[model samples]
Target: MSFLAKIFRRRPRPKLDLSHPQVVALSARLRALHAMPISSKEEVAAWEVEAEKLRERLYEDYKEVYDSLPHEIEHYLVDVDIRAKDPGYAKYQAEQLVELLSLPEEMPNQSPEPMPLKRHGSS
Candidate 1:
């Protein structure tokens, strides 16, 4: 019931410019329509009509680009020389695993008496 709804209700067939604010306004409108209760026939009809309009705008405005994008960044290849490289990373991980595996067997669960470390300068 705001002014934008009035402007949008007019089936003025201009292709939605995603680069402009109208697309954003349409998106907000769609969200509002979606959030409304579905109990009434009137609300359902309005939602359907608006949604079809939006779909047309979206398809007409921008069709080839798919919306669902993977979260990963597709940038430059991983540095082969760095520790992050799969081979190098695996080697580093193996070294850490080896260190962990070769840890001195847990001294039988007896309480550890504090050993006094030899201090060189300060007593």
Candidate 2:
């Protein structure tokens, strides 16, 4: 790989941060525990114990990244104003409901010849 390409390469998003094989297995179990339907108080107690162990392990593994996150810019919001003139095909009056609305002069249809509508009031 070129030096510039290596430097500019994008890093993949972090999923799990634990180092040990047993701890990684425990982490998957912890996630499965959250998804499972537990009925008894004993099950709940066991879940809480597993969760606390996982939490401690994760904090130890990624302490620097976790601590620095609060100081870093966390959220981003961008406001944009979009002004669009209605394309005018969406609605029509009850009196002229029988007649089809012609496409706008700015936008021509696929038809070879567009027959202009004769208004009731206009000449």
Candidate 3:
């Protein structure tokens, strides 16, 4: 590779270390939130607030990872109303967030890359 190419080539970002104390605490908080019972709209509202707070913290502390997250996971982080209305879905979203933070350091494809789409009726 040429000198300029070497300098300009993108480097893979280091993965989020799940074993860090702060990450562990954040994961625990998400699990706790997932386990909470949703008995009423008030509870759901409260849950939404807590989830948003967690999302903000995640984004603030890990901006690179947050920005690189898959679109579905990012959507879950932003869509409070949908999560509030469905407890099961909220749990799933929380799980996804935790998994995101806990991803192994050596895992491949940390960066988003486009995959070829299959054309209809082209088996």
Each candidate's TM vs. the true structure? 0.29, 0.28, 0.47
Per-residue lDDT tens digits of candidate 3, residues 1-123?
A: 999999899766456655556555655665555555445667667767877777777767656455444445456646656665665665465545645433344224454222222221134
Q: On TM-score, who's better, 1 or 3?
A: 3
Per-model CA lDDT versus the true structure: 0.35, 0.34, 0.55
lDDT winner among the candidates?
3
lDDT value, residue 107 of candidate 3: 29
Q: lDDT score of model 1?
A: 0.35
For candidate 3, list the clashing residue pairs, or say none: none
Q: What's the lDDT for residue 104 in model 3?
A: 41
How many clashing residue pairs appear in each of the predictions shown? 0, 0, 0
Give lDDT tens digits, candidate 2, residues 45-111.
Answer: 5545654554556556545444422211111000000001111321122112211122233223343
Q: Which scores greater on lDDT, model 1 or model 2?
A: 1
Ordered by TM-score, highest first, the candidates read 3, 1, 2
Question: What lDDT does candidate 3 reach at residue 3?
Answer: 100
Candidate 2 weakest ten by summed lDDT: 75-84
User: Which residue pairs does candidate 1 place in steric collision?
Assistant: none
Show model 2 residue runs off by greater than 4 Å. Answer: 1-30, 68-123
